[model samples]
Target: MFSPFERMVAGRYLRARKAEGFVSVIAGFSFAGIMLGVATLIIVMSVMNGFRQELVTRILGLNGHINVYSLSAPLEDYSIMKLQIGDVPGVTSVSGIIESQALMTINGYSTGVMVRGMTRDDLMKKPVLSDHFIEGEPADFVGYSAAIGRLMSEKLNLKIGSTFTLVSPKAKVTPFGGMPSSRTFTVAMIFDVGMYEYDSNFIFVPLDAAQAFYQMGKAVSSLEIVTKNPQHLNTVKRDISLITDGVAGVYDWRDNNSSFLNALQVERNVMFLILTMIILVAAFNVISSMIMLVKDKGRDIAIMRTMGATRRSMMKIFILTGASIGVVGTFVGTALGIAFALNIESIRQFLQGLTGTELFSEEIYFLSKLPAVIDWNEVIAVIAMAFTLSILATLYPAWRAARLDPVEALRYE
Candidate 1:
């Protein structure tokens, strides 16, 4: 019913001519709080998504979509295996890979590195390696040649034409004992992939050069398989397993970096959950303001009750008030959040320039700058949570409004 009492209360609250300045301040703070919380959550989740995407791209690009290896000994007749595996569905290219761990030294600086050997012809087919040349050339291996990562080169003070010694543990026996020993090589080129781990630890060489250095004759360490569709890596792995008679182990990129990827996902989820609570707290400010409004309009509510207004109607009115605040706050927050997520890179750069400090310092973060990839799903989840919390916050205030006794409410007036 459109009673004067109901109209008077709603009009007074909406017009704000008689509203307390403190209530207005509380409402303003509540709106700002929600905006900041939503914006932060979106930006943070998007950045995490960005890192995850980057890691997958760089790791899978450099490494193959899938790898096939033998647990017993190095693979024999790898060329035969390559042809057979290539015939399988989803298989694009299968290349022989010889890899060994070794220590490299240049200008008296030493670092541990993974030496991966590939044929020049096969290397041309691999987009990952082909795309990252920063100095000199790719692997020639004619007379002890190799392409090292940019970070490793910098760490060891290496450059193009710099003769670095790659000392690998050799299998030479001595009169004293049959203990493994070491050997050396030279640096030919430098490549940068923008991934700290790979850039600092991988060195590319010719397959024969690696085999000879590691004393592995007629044996290949692993088979790197590139699929036509990277999304079907598991299917390719299964096909390879069937063809290889299960003698070899097939591993996909997901298996290789499971722990790190899982940790990143968990971290992102936890951060969003924690930050969403800030919005929930801010929504409570709406509850407090609504409850105070009900108290201030007690006489008006009593008059409405006398005019046969139902308690449910009174409840709906206050609930609408609380919900309106939430609607306004959620709308503002969602807009701000999307904006921040999309422009995160620019914001990071501006902050870095303003402070004269890097957001991601190489010495600390392993990255020169922050990387962000906005995940729309995460943004939507944050918005949903804020809206739910805002609506939930109104319940207590609405209940109080519904429970008011008309006689007691109007006795003082």
Candidate 2:
């Protein structure tokens, strides 16, 4: 409960005179420091959060949440495993899948690719793959035809109806020691999953064709199971474990990409702590400026004490004065941070165009675009932390001003 007199005095002190310009400048720096610190913290945190969310969505969209692989051999009884896993309460769909590494050669160029064997119906269930058709049709996906990513198609000069040779290193034994297995398949579909890794390294083919190519008759490499939510996969894993008789590798997307996700989280936390020091430094500015103000207005305080103003009044006035800077800065910073986060992609593109440089590259960061997602709780916590530090910074100066001996102060004046 700040009184009218206290507020009036605090306001007057904040409107610095010609002689108090230096103190006011310090206060300005304090305000700026806090504002920039809060803004930077919010922007960085939001970007990290968005990056993690986008990665999970794309990764899980292409791959299953839970992957069950047969430990000793190829999954010969995948149909039974699929049915049993499909019955799990949280499980959405279970499909037989075969994934293997092979070299694809075309137009005198060769690159390593992961061959994924999925039925057309099951492929359509993946929104990232099904919806991102850069230059292919759904009808083209059936038969001996295969689907290739946009990057793969671009790099190897492939298109719908164009064929490429897949060379498998797993050679068959023959009279001439061993011979490599190789086959040519037509490209019927092309997709851009927006992830550089997937776009450049993945090829999809129908299940039966993949079985024939891989020489695994009625056998699959693994079972891919999708869940209603990837975050709540523990119960789903337990249910699936009941079906798998106990070996579930890559039980969820987090497990599959643990190192990458954990790095993002660790980097986020470290950045928060590092950036918070900016606000902490700003609080010191508040303390230094407030102490200088008290020294400069010592005579005025002596007069006020002599005029019967209570010590509590002096303390309250100074608290209001210093806190005004911190409070205003925090609110302004929050607004600036949210606005920046919302338009981060547009801003990044504009900056890139203006500067003629690649600011965010898909090859390094994985996503084709920069993303930002603001969490309001973090914003509130930042504001509170800054406000508390600022108020605390004003305490020593305000206390010294309140405890000034009127007679002793006048003798010096």
Candidate 3:
């Protein structure tokens, strides 16, 4: 039985090490370049993907997938609207939410806050808020109780059972002046969502308490709807709008955070492209090495041609060599990438402590730590790309080797 052309060429290239010292070094560098590039690309992309996933899960967990707000004033019949919206396809849950600007004061320390009022039953449905009590109970809001964010609590120096006055500005007709303002309630509990913006600005109070404070008679600013599948948020929003006869404006998660998501996607793509260049440059090194190999083995090639070795066979040999570099490098890189992605949190903490500075500060990046999410599709793509570039890089040198005339090569030798 005859050996296949690919196998013969691969075996020969693999064994041709003694006289090919420089070629080996070039191949090694090519492998190293691809390994580093692919690993870096995977790790970076996974981290970005992780951050994006965390944002959606955390933010959407607290804030519903869609919000139905009145275009004119407050929603008239929140109960009826909730029922109607809940009946919409894909709508899993609906809750009425009231938002008002208020000043919270304790011990002469005053801070402006956005009070989010919700019923105890509705509060339980919000996973983000429900899991992050850290201090007090949501059900305790029946008697002037409030759940403040962690940052807000820190800034105001508040704790559980701490009494703080909530001064909400309300327009009232006065005899001596054009307008008069009235204050609202008192703070009760503090909550932390691990997100700076929410923790620093938002406070949760009882729905009835907020209604009385704002002089709203059983009306809410918006009805937050949670869907079974977030990908169908627009569909859910549209259904809600149709059910309400277009009287209310329905907003989906995409509308609320499109810019941030877009930025994350752009950054991921840019990073991949940049890192892929490293592998490309390394593939070019393979080209240089193959060209050198052709020069060094001119005599051997001429003798082989004289002995009836085909041009196609010579080309296969060089191509196989280049491809082997890519294959080995890709395998190593993929392993390293998966490992790093799985342990990114610990790696991030180590670096943070080593640098003596917080790498992912909640105050700065909206997250307190790094995140990494490995996608197998991305891994497959990188491997395919690396192998393709490696094979492509061999074309010119392989062609030159194949085109060499036996007589000319022999004469030079």
Candidate 4:
């Protein structure tokens, strides 16, 4: 605890007069550096957190948490498999899916895309796909009818009730050797899953339509499944393996998109490390300011020592002066950072409007809007680091001031 005299002197030192203008300026820069460092760290970390969360929800929602496949062949009896998988503990829903690569032609434009098939009920269960219906209802996706993503719809200039021709790899032998099977389909609906990759390259049709078109009969390529807790996928996979008698292979969302997710995590960590350097630099400012303040107050240190002030009191006074700047800077920075993060979406929109340029373009980041998610624990950790660094920066300077010899310091005065 600081004595009244120590607190008074510390406060007066921080509010340095015109004669100590240089010291005051150094202190001000130190304060500003700490504030900017902390704020930048908070904003960057929040954006990364938001991005990862969006990637998980928006991407995994349509894709399901896990995939179950028959190791030997296509899943012919998916009804029984779905029922069995659904009964497994932690299993939420099981949807049969048929997936194949095909080329779609519309308005003289030919583009390759991934075609997927699922029942109306199954499609409805995936809110990421179902809730984003921009054009038509799921019921409209009947036999020979398909749903396309918004990007695809735009690129192909398709609309509800517009027709397109899908060419399959399956060929029919004829006098012309082999000809790819082709079918005409009417566009029934359009959806936007937010991810450009999916929106630009995926199409969905009724399960029966896909089976009939692909000559797959009742067989499905795989079973898409959702679980109660996606984070516990390995445990759930093990349980599902028991139910399937290990005949079917199981892969979680991580397995399906490991590279992308891993890259995100690695980038997040690297960014954190890189941004932490800013705070360290700010901490160096604190050290410099404290050292300069100690030098400027050498006469005061000598006077106080002659007045019977203990070395401990001298150290405490300087420590309090320097650490106060850090504390105040950290607090102000935290408030600013959280406030900015909370309003980041609005700020992004405002900036885009002002600049009249697209920000957070779907074509670039696969997200149309900027995202910000504040993690309180990370915020707390940043604050702790800043506060601790501030306290540490004062130690050496404070010690030097406390060890000053009154006779020697006053001799130069």
Candidate 5:
């Protein structure tokens, strides 16, 4: 608690008159620096949090929480394995899947693609695969029918009922030499997963069609498993691996996308440290302004000390002045940061239009829009650090003021 005398003195020092204009200017700069620093840090961290959340919801939703694979061969009896895995305590759904690389040619346009093979039941189990149908229905993919991503369809100029040729590198040996296996498939549907990578490079075919074309007999590449709580994937994956006797390789979604996600985390941490320097710089500014204020008010400090004001009172007054700046700056910065984060997409769109450019290009990032989510814990931490730094900045200058001898100070006057 500040005494009336300390509060009055602190307020007077903070509102420096025209005679001490230089100190006022320095204090203003310190306030602005802290405000900008806190706001920028919050906005950046919120965006990173949003990115991670989007990946978990959209990307991991399309893929599996955990993937079970054979150590050396395909899972021949995937149905039995699927049942066993589904019976696990936390498992929600298990689907047999086949993933392979191939080339597709349509209207003289050929592009390499990753082919996904799944049954109608398996397709229906994952909403990410089944929900975004732009053409035909999942139930209609019965024969040599396939589904293509919207981006792929647009690139190759394909439509429903259009026919395309699939070429697999698994060649069939003949009397003359080995010839690549080729087949024609009718396009049954088109889907948009929103993610540019998936939309541009993935296609879905009937499990039987994939088996016949790939020359796979009663075998699937892996089992994709979803859990009731994706957050518990590590424990569930370990349990599944143990139950399966380690004959299969169990991998979680984070493991599959470790490099990409790790890059995000690393960038987030580095940005936090870098942005924190801004606040540190502002705190140094507080020290500079406080020192100047003490020097200019040396006569007042001497008179106050002679009038029975303790050293502790002088320290408290200066600390209050410095911390008031930080407190006000922190609050203003938080409000600005939250407002900006909540409307970041709109801001990004406006900037993009103004500059005639794409702020978040789908080609480079997984998300097509700017994402942000405020974390209150991070905000609180930033405020605490700023306030502490501001109080610390006043220590040396406050001590110097308290130690000034009245006789010496008045002699100079």
Candidate 6:
């Protein structure tokens, strides 16, 4: 606790007179550095957090949490498999998917895409496909119709009720050779999952139609499953393994996309370390400025000591003076960071409009919009780290001021 006299002296020292202009400039620079460092760290971390969360949501929303595939052959009697998987303790829903790589063409425009076949009921189980409809509604997903992505629809110049030909390599082969199979399917639904790749490269069709087109009979490529808690899928996976009895292979989303997720985590950690250095540099600036302030005010420290000020009081005064910069800068920086992060997308768009260029490209980032999610815990951690550094930075300089000898300081002056 600072005494009234100590607080007054600290406050007086912080206020710059005309003769102390250079010291004030140094203090100002240190304040700006701390402010910018904290703000940059918060904004970048928020964006990274938001980016990872949004990707996970869209990926798992469309793909489910776990995948089951036949180890020896394609999954036959998939309906029974679905029912058994659904009955598992943590299991929520199981959808049989007949996936095949095929080229789709219309009016001389063609692109290769994955065709995922699902029954209407099974399609409804996946919220991403069932919920997102930019053009047609869920009721139209019946019969031989297909659900396409928004980007695909745009690229091929398609619309509701527009027909496209899907050509598959798998077909019945006679004595002549092999003939590629092709079928015309009307676009019943167009959806946007917000991810650039998934939106542009997937087509969904009725299970019966897909089976007929692929000559798959009643077999499915795999079983896509959702669970109550994806994070604890090991137990569910083991249970599913027992239920399937070695007929299938089971894996979770983490297993399927481990490398990509690990990459994101690594990048997040690296960015945090790199940004923390900025704050560290600002702390160094605080130390340098405080030391200089102590040296410049040596005679003042001597005079105050002669006026009955204790050494402890001198230390407290200097500490308070230096810490004021850190505390105030951190508070202002925190407010600025949160405000900027919350409006980052709008700001990005505004900049893009002003520059006449796309700022957040869906093709490069796989997301159409910039995201910023401020984790309160992370923000608290940042504040604690900065506050601690600021307090520590003032210690040595404050100690130096407290140790000043009145005779030595006055004799030199």
- lDDT for model 4, please: 0.89
lDDT of 2 by residue, 308-366 (tens): 89999999989999999898988888889989999999999999999999999888998
Supply every candidate's count of residue pairs whose N, Cα or C atoms clash at under 3 angstroms.
2, 0, 0, 0, 0, 0
Per-model TM-score versus the true fold: 0.88, 0.97, 0.91, 0.96, 0.94, 0.97
Candidate 6 total steric clashes: 0
The regions of model 6 sitting more than 4 angstroms off are none
Candidate 3 clash pair list:
none
Q: In candidate 1, which residue pairs clash? A: 166-185, 170-181
Worst 10 residues of 6 by lDDT: 122-131
lDDT of 3: 0.80
Overall lDDT per candidate, in order of appearance: 0.77, 0.88, 0.80, 0.89, 0.87, 0.89
Q: Over the stretch 108-133, how does candidate 1's per-residue lDDT look in tens digits?
A: 77777888888887766766667778
Prediction 6 TM-score vs. true: 0.97
Location of the lowest summed lDDT over 10 successive residues in candidate 3 = 178-187
TM-score between model 3 and native: 0.91
User: 188-210 in candidate 4: lDDT tens per residue?
Assistant: 99998888888999999999999
Which residue pairs does candidate 2 place in steric collision? none
lDDT of 5 by residue, 201-257 (tens): 888899989988888887988888988887767778878998667578998988888
lDDT of 6 by residue, 1-413 (tens): 88899889889988979898888888888898889888998999999999999988888888879898888878877787788889999888888888889999999988899999989888777777677888887788877799998999998889999999999978668788788889999999998888898899999999999998898888888999999987788889988988788688887899888998999999999999999898889888988888888988998999989999999999999899989999998999999999999999999989998999998889999998899999999999999999999999999999999999999999956
Model 1 alpha-carbon drift over 4 Å, by segment = 1-19, 139-143, 173-186, 304-313, 363-367
* Every model: Cα RMSD to truth: 3.3, 1.5, 2.6, 1.5, 1.9, 1.4
Cα lDDT for residue 259, candidate 1: 98
Ranking by lDDT: 4, 6, 2, 5, 3, 1
Give me the runs in candidate 2 sitting further than 4 Å from their true place.
246-250
Backbone clash tally (model 4): 0
